[model samples]
Target: MEESDTTKYVIHAHISAEGVVERPDVVGAVFGQTEGLLGADLDLRELQKTGRIGRIEVNITSKYGKSSGNILIPSSLDKVETSILAAALETIDRVGPCISKISVTKIEDVRSSKRQQIIERAKHILTAMFDETVPESQELTEAVKSAVRVEEVTFIDNLPAGPDVLDSDAIIVVEGRADVLNLLRAGIKNAIAVEGTNVPQLVAELSKKKTVTVFTDSDRGGDLILKELLQVADVDYIARPPEGKSVEDLTQKEIIKALRSKVPVEQVVEVPQRRRNKQQMQQQEAARAEQNGKHEAQQREYQREYQRPERPERERGETPRRKSLRRMEERQERREPPKEQEQQPEARKPEPREAGEFAEIMKDLAGTLSAKLLDANKNVLQKVAVRDLANVLKETNGEVKSVVFDGVITQRMLDIAAEKNLEYLVGVKMGSIVKQPANVKVITTE
Candidate 1:
């Protein structure tokens, strides 16, 4: 009992005696009856002396000359030893001259209960006691990817460029090293820099062999560089940042938008040259003003000469002056031709009629849960409910040039439309689309 603190298991039993018995009688019966029943090694007395077993506990109740109660015994012994000792106790049949019966019930392991408590506490500590500032796996992956891409800007022929420039069929030409780094961040690797307004020979040679797109800052310098590159290099296309936005500062979405909206070189050549025309117009206006000033002085002298008081018949014959005035008017008519209209800079072709027609079709189909497929000519070739859009588009040939619907354009539908090579997608709104095709146009009301 004094060594009970080392106990690993507790034994429980029910004791029933035919005759009334006290606690002392029950305890005595257990030891007296079980001693030497198995072997000397498992003797209850020896186990107690060795602190392998604790003192036995007996609770008794007396009613109608009968005793029935429970017994508890603590054991420091192993599993088999404890069970053998508990079973021997059941052999007790007499308690102070009365018939008795003991039934071994159950054994509870103390270590197991303690281990369960520990597990519960550990769960609470793990959740409530730790800092939660750790980022998600996806966020960490994105951060590392961005870092790697930004560091991958390499130099080719002393020009800052991405490593993929030589291998890719088409290359993007930017103004400076920063623009190349920014394009790398957007996962566009085939980019090289011009480094200044003067187009580099390396870029020009490469442009002649491979397709080039000159992307630059959204300012006068960018435009000037663009025009210079246009003359020196074989630019297949031209891409520009949005108004007042730098290419290096554009987000991935904006970068893709600019690149997708790139127009053919033919469509862009006259644009900058129009500014050249404006300069020429300014110079012509200055020359014309100088000539007009000279003409005004001459006119003042001619009027003074004509106003001189009555001259002789020889000086005024039919007014040698009136005929001379007629002749001067004839010379002026011959010198200056008809005043022509000043040429205005031609604007880029208006927005594709397909966009406006799509918008109108979208408005008409709104709230009707319907979709319209149009050919390149803005003629509706087929109309169907929105639910059947995917199946219909799949079954149709590549002749369907555009799609306008009354519902949101989800990623699934967008992919299907793109896979079918549809040119335009006009919807009431757009859903969370992860992949946007560059060739396909997406439009939403809001």
Candidate 2:
């Protein structure tokens, strides 16, 4: 056998034949034998038939030496022929060498194509099965995450009604689901709750649809929540009760009173300047006047007694006690009256200056008219007729931005008031047309 590095395996042979076997024919024989042994296809005929092939060399050893060494077989048949060949080689080496003996050694165990193809097919099937099932739900979960949208909105289940209650010309925002329920129980119908600090998208949209007011608790948590909301929300007002008070804790009457007495958020931030108590001051003045009146009456009586002439008594059996009493009075009259009594007013302190103080009186009106105009219930406000504005103005201590009327005002009326520069005429009912004043805004709310 010729040794070559390029071949995957080498088989060395000491053939007792006359000439070398064809290398191609030997290769083919090896292939055919392996095919039969390993249940595969192996073509080995090319090596065995070419008798003059130089690919394999036949070395004849005349010394008749016994050869022994370890040979490595091809990977495919390494395990299959190892034990059989090892035992055979051991048995052959022990025999005498003079008699000719056939010895076999395998250096390669090449495999055929058919077996490898079957293994590859099995791997492909396993890979395909894995690909089909693992990620089915994963894709759906990702799409669900991507497709849906959530928005923030103030939500409520109910509300209440009354003049003292806060009305919703602007939307009212509260704290939780339960607070909204409580407000509804108190008869405030146009209220919504924030539910939490997270302003939902729906609530945000509704706020834009109407003016918004944030009504929260008076504590730190409520303050924090309010701060977060105001940072992003378009709110028109804030209504906070006394610190530590919650809407849920307020009774219906407390709710009404708080609403009726609510101070604007802007005003809340300013220094407190509530007026001194007028009723108490007035009561004190009245008492002072009454005390002065009693003193004056006593002073007048003392003066009358002093001016009366002393009368001589006609002595009878009792020695005229009146004369003695008159003399005693004369002596008493020489003593001065108490200083307070001497200084007392002649009549009840003239009623406090009542005239030319209309402006001061108007300042004390209970509710501001202008604030009511701006802050009244949208439903009730929308129904206020123009004629009614005058009465509202008289009743309110606030200013009116514009007057809304039920019936029409004629061009004559506009002409009369043209010099005043009124900007608009708003009516809930139909109104007569006023022409030629192009700058005036006129709207009918019917």
Candidate 3:
């Protein structure tokens, strides 16, 4: 039997002879029986000559003049030819002049075994050599954000705060340094921590100047801190974390939602100056300039409230608050001499018919996110969406007189309206308006 290394399949067969037979007799019987059984394409002699058929091996044992053994033939032929050659091996009825019987046992795929070994070897290499230190994109982003926030956090009045705490028009007051850090991580640059339950005098003064919202955990400590701030500082609103959660534990989304859903400080805790004791009054006192600014802000706030009558339903339970605010306004008024009050000019509001027309247009445009340009006679000169209102108004010559929309009126829109010499502007709500057009009257639905 010849030997060849490029083998893909091995055929095994069992042989038994009527008389004693050796391995040579068994190998010769296999080749000779299957020689012409298949065509020239699969001839065993031709396959062996081309090295397509590997060595034929046999193992035998002779006992009591009887022989039993197994034959093995390796082939690289296609499956159809290999199976046919295997099947033909069973037709051998004699082995080299001896009556013999042969039966095919099994065929093994050499390549399949090699493939399994390759796979197990690859697994070992992967486990031992590959790098596993790479982190996910989200984790990398969080790490970079934490580093940047740590750099931007500053100290205000020796209390931890975001960089913009002193400059922003609105500020958030939290419980501790950790809460301030969390707010900084959320990209809120106007947050400052009180550091404890005792409200600092700086935060109280800031409350008198800028809008202040007290934000804290929803636990017992938070409630006590909120009460202390309400008594000592002029807080505008109160924002609480979720039940059983601390401010530092809130995610960015939860923090934003809590601030957005904040309630007015008066609604959360009503403390009428008329009802407060002398000590509480002393705690709530401020400098004369702060008092003046606070009174003017209150007057403007009440003026805006008077323009929108949506408070009629809420007036029942707010009587004490209303009286308190009224008394404060009267005291501020009496302090200002008659001459200074006369010199201060007030902006004129829209006329009843024109104001009603603007209100009607605003009501009709509700939820539409659209705007309308009106002529002097309340005629719609042009209609555009709120997003394009400023650009469209800028392009118009002077045909547009009044503007009405179902969106919040911003200061930029007001400036554009003033440039266009528009007479009146009306919107669903008014945003922070620092600069008012002296000639143009601005009205809001509420």
lDDT (tens digit, per residue) of candidate 3 on 1-446: 45355677889889888888898788777777877787786788888888888878899999998899888898876555678888888888989877888899999887887899999999998678756565675587589988774545789779888889889999999988888888877888899999888788899889777888889876557768877887788777778876546788689999999898786543333443532453355656655667889779888877665655354545566554575566667867888564532232233455787677766777788765568888889899887756457778989989888888866666677789889899888876555466777877877665
What is the model-wide C-alpha lDDT for candidate 2?
0.44
The numbered model that scores best in TM-score is 3
Give a tens-digit lDDT track for model 2, residues 1-446.
44233223333333231223333333333333333442222212222233211243333333334322222222221222333332333222212222223245544422333357778987897667556566676787578977652222232323222222234566667777656666766766666766677766655665545666677776655767666665555555566654335777577887776666554433222111221233346778998999999789767766665556654434343233455556557867997875552331111121234222222322332122221133222222323322233334455433333333333344443443243444444432222232446544444332
Worst 10 residues of 3 by lDDT: 338-347
lDDT of each: 0.78, 0.44, 0.77
Q: Per-candidate TM vs. native?
A: 0.30, 0.24, 0.31
Candidate number with the higher TM-score (2 or 3): 3
RMSD of each: 30.7, 41.0, 29.1
Compared to the true structure, candidate 3 yields what TM-score? 0.31
Ranking of candidates on TM-score, top first:
3, 1, 2
